[model samples]
Target chain A: MGPPTLHELFNPVLFYVLLTLGAVGVALASPRKGVSPQIIGGLVVGAAFGGVLVLLGIRGNEAGDLPNLYFYVFALIAILSGLRVITHPKPVYAAIYFILTILSSSAMYLLMQAEFMAFALIIIYAGAILITYLFVIMLATQAPSEEKVASLEGYDSTAREPLTATLAGFALLAVLTGMMAHGMSDLQDSRQVIRPSVHSLEAPILGVLPNKVIREFEQAAVFDHGIAEPTVEEVNDGFDANLRTMAFKIEDRERFDHGLETDTRFRSMLPETIHGDTVLVTLPAERGITNAEGVGFTLIAKHPMALEIAGIILLMAMLGAVVLARKQIELGEDEKAAQLRTLGQGFDDDVAHVGGGM
Target chain B: MITSLAHIAEPVTTVAPDIFGDVGVSLYHYLFVSATLFALGVIGFLTRRNMIVMFLCTEMMFQAAGLALIAFSKYHLNHSGEVFVIFVLTIAAAEAALALALVVLLFRRRETLNAEDWALLRG
Candidate 1:
């Protein structure tokens, strides 16, 4: 009824679903023969990757260790590489650069303890995509003639302006820079206090215990661990008096029974209740500590559908890439020969022209 | 000489003031690194005519972003930023795949993969 709890938001299943969606988005968006699709795919993938982490409860105060930092670094690299791939003129280099980006990103995932994701990235991107790209390049055609190279050089140097792309790239860079700067500044100002507090020292030790057990320990310390049994004021005072008398006897042992009167005041200050004794304590129900681990356990164990969806999406992408990359010859032998003849003629003419000029 | 070396080692061993506390690498350092990387990427993007070099420059930009994200994540001790990084890797992989494929196709048709030769798509 109220806003959904943090447990609901931290659902691993939800994270998987988001990841799957991102994969599908990439598959749909990647260009069949151009850089636009690849760029879009990269953006979608980056968003999905980031979204999963956010949904999986890795962000904010919940993040742990340096692995998370590496994960972020990888994602940022992926996004920038994707942008470069689409915008860059030379396609082959973009491809190689993108691969490097992916590999580094995978390393980041490995750092984050996402072993499965990291391995998958290496296998799919590096092993399959890169090899396939190389094969395609080798099978495609010969290198351009010197004339063609010269023309290309001319075009690059004196081509029509890519005004829109330049403006867009600059704008995006500015926005990203601004956001990064702002986030860094905010974090710097909201400095985390590094005081040598009990919590800081004992957190590693306490983290080993189950959340519920730890909560119980805290509650027991307050109420059941030699505290005055909660009751009406008059009833509690009598219990307190008995606890004080017991403490006085313990203190008297150290002073040969001579300091009993002197330590009576100190003894009275001791808690009234004994261990394992049930007291009529009426603790506020709302004051109970929420078990963080309990919430995480329930979310992961409860939702299996999200995981299945993510798997299916990955499979779809793999299948789609296979289909797209399947070798199919459209031209007949005669047509191929004719094309080769034309290429040969073009080559000869260029050679003859160079000879004549010399 | 040994005593002098020991004196030097004392400062080395306790370089960071415990009183000031140890936060690994300040925000300013992170910002400076990020800025330098970004500037490098921008210059490469602007000056380089080779498409591969341009992509490399873009990768540099990404590296900058990654550095920034990592710096922030470490400071915040948050895993979300890292998780976001994983998604970035996945996308980059896909982009590389398709971009390479296109490059091969372009070369087959035009016999060149140079940026200047890609006037077919312009007008």
Candidate 2:
């Protein structure tokens, strides 16, 4: 009846509940203008989901990697900011949010073990495109006339063309449904890929433990005792039970005896043998690849293409932005000069009229 | 205690008849999230009639697509999903530029930013 395990926190139902709560919290906290509750809710949900994943042993490729959580949080923030770009009324504010979103999404990419994509997302989207958007917004700020403002206010009423919006929404939903169905079908097939083989379980553990101790144990136990070698399952089950007991004892040592037989029981549970006696022990390979060099190798060598494509995409995006933003004035020199003179004359006349009226 | 924790930690493996019963952060979750986002984008696009906001909705769609890709990638344990996401980000940036340029051009032509006022482009 009580909560069973920490992993239950990751249960989809629990995750959904947390998501709903976070969404409600965000909606309540948001200011009364601009972005809808949905966008804010998405941001809050994404951040919380990523945070919970980290806390619940889903961090990176392995469990217990907490720093990666920051990357997900950043991505969520970036996404929120990006959403704000369109939601905000002010162009400057939109640009700011867009920039923040790009930066955060990039951080998310890094967190997902895709370092190259993250940097590319930031450099191209945030550095180039958003700046260009800002420039265009700034340059195009000819104050709207009173009539134009009045029209904009009225536009919202007429804008709700239900037929078109609904049709598009339904179409999107259909496509999403189809895609989701396909994805789930594929996932169902993938369960067969890893069959929880005996070797797969033991190899990782055996790879990590000291070879010298293993050899010494093997010589003493197998050669001397003439006992059949225990299977990987036996070792793992024994180790699991022993570890649980040790953990429980650590929490209440006075209640548990601190003796060699107690330690021997733990040792006998271990799969590895020593001195013809069933020694209870814990294997080491559970902590895979802790060296800095190994970490670097895993990052760079394993996923070079992801990194390269991210870089190329960012570069191309930047170049494209520069080209798009390069202004082309179509006016000839004489026409421009004549127009400026006429504009100047109009300005002077307006200034004189205002001065005389004042 | 460990056994109890294990039971709590593990999701109910047995499937129920409900639509959501089998959905354990699967492709459907990605699609559901995407659809909601796409709907929001559409709503924003239609209701606001502001070119900037419309473009923002388009970005929202792009984000949804990225999310979908990532979810699929996670299911497959492949990097291609992420690669597709990178492409989406690039396309989004390019689209933003073109959209803003068009918005600026429209503003210059009609001397108004309201979409309703810019019917000159209509066939």
Candidate 3:
């Protein structure tokens, strides 16, 4: 893909048309008005959805580009659900819609091959966090009766400042989408961005993996065994296996310094081949390293301090919540008087003295 | 084997740009998705009356940020963006806990979930 073109960034005409239609529909729908305009608004939003993708054109009509379909499908689900979350009269329904938004976004994460984040979104956001919202909604909502659906009754029925809010929200969306479309051409160059290779590793962690264990792999020959193991011949042997290891891109002072910075022991275990300034040491891929491993490696190895700080933040939240939720004990009249008496000392109120004494 | 070590220690050059020209999604697609998600969250946050729902919008915003970070990570082939997502997840979990507790406490006081009803909070 060359640099993005003007049309690829956006369709300005759709922005005005869709915004106008959406704002009008929301205005019509928000006031508990007739259903026709509301339905029309939904349809307009849906059309605008398709229009946004069309204007994007990155995922244009090409059978070859199926991944784009997943993006469109999931994004539509999230967008519609997000709109419903604000528009729905019932708080419980809004919670459910929020779940949809999360699930759809997780699907987007999966498309990007972020398996860890995708599943985390489901288990944490949809599972734990959303369940809490549902419970709160249930606890906070008045029980509906024969006259009304008590579960969803009251202030939730009508949005707060529906017309202005919807207009403002859509305006924000419009500005953002418009900016992404038009403002990003210069920054959106199609440079040949490659996936990070093994050479990117600053740590000799791969170097320290037991040579005996390393020898088991078929592609072990290319591995510069930090010991005096022979470099694999560039013969058809490795070709048959089709398995490759990440080889060092550079072997120099900078790489060694990085190893030392991470850990002296880790740096010390470096094979002579690695420390000797040769870059072709191929680190064998661990058994369970999907793309997520890089993320974990960064947390555990590169940015261990961040992991610890996250734990601290969670601990603090737990403490704060517990403190906030604790019951407030009531004071007896005598106890209250005693408290007031102590306060009187500061003001030096002789007549207001507690226990009727000076 | 020892003789080949010198060759290996230097550069094992990658193929030219055209050599590995595999077509895939661009960085912009992910960015677009993330931006939309965030905007939806912002709209929901502004427009929703339910306190819990508003926080839900905030969580959605966090999700949007995570998506964008992961995509940028993929774009640069770097792991920092992905690792930052771990922190984002942590903060979201923390926010949810504290925010919900506060919501419950507020609801107990006001007996209503409407944002407008809690107007006299400071006095």
Using TM-score, give the best candidate's number.
Answer: 3
- Tens-digit lDDT track of model 2 for A66-152: 333364456446535543543455556755875675566555544444455556667776677667777776665545675665554
Number of the top DockQ candidate: 3
When 2 and 3 are scored with TM-score, the better candidate is: 3
Clashing pairs in 3: A144-A150, A278-B9, A279-B9
TM-score of 2: 0.47
RMSD of each: 20.1, 15.7, 9.7
lDDT of 1 by residue, A183-207 (tens): 5433434544422221122111112
| lDDT tens readout by residue for model 3, A59-157 | 433312234457878877887786677677777888899899889988987776777778987998899888988987787675434543452366556
Clashes of each: 11, 9, 3
For all candidates in order, the CA lDDT equals 0.42, 0.46, 0.60
The DockQ of each candidate is 0.06, 0.15, 0.29
Could you give the DockQ of candidate 1? Answer: 0.06
Candidates' chain B TM-scores in the order shown: 0.68, 0.72, 0.77
Candidate 1 structure quality by residue, lDDT tens digits, B7-119: 11101001111211122223323433354346436644654454544545665666566555544443443323333444444454455555554555445445554656554
Q: Over 4 Å off in model 1, which ranges?
A: A1-185, A189-358, B1-25, B42-53, B121-123
- Candidate 3: regions farther than 4 A off: A19-38, A58-66, A142-152, A186-200, A203-242, A248-288, A327-358, B1-26, B121-123
Name the runs in model 2 displaced over 4 angstroms. Answer: A1-123, A144-167, A174-183, A190-328, A331-358, B1-31, B121-123
Which run of 10 residues does model 3 chain A get worst, by summed lDDT?
A: A213-222
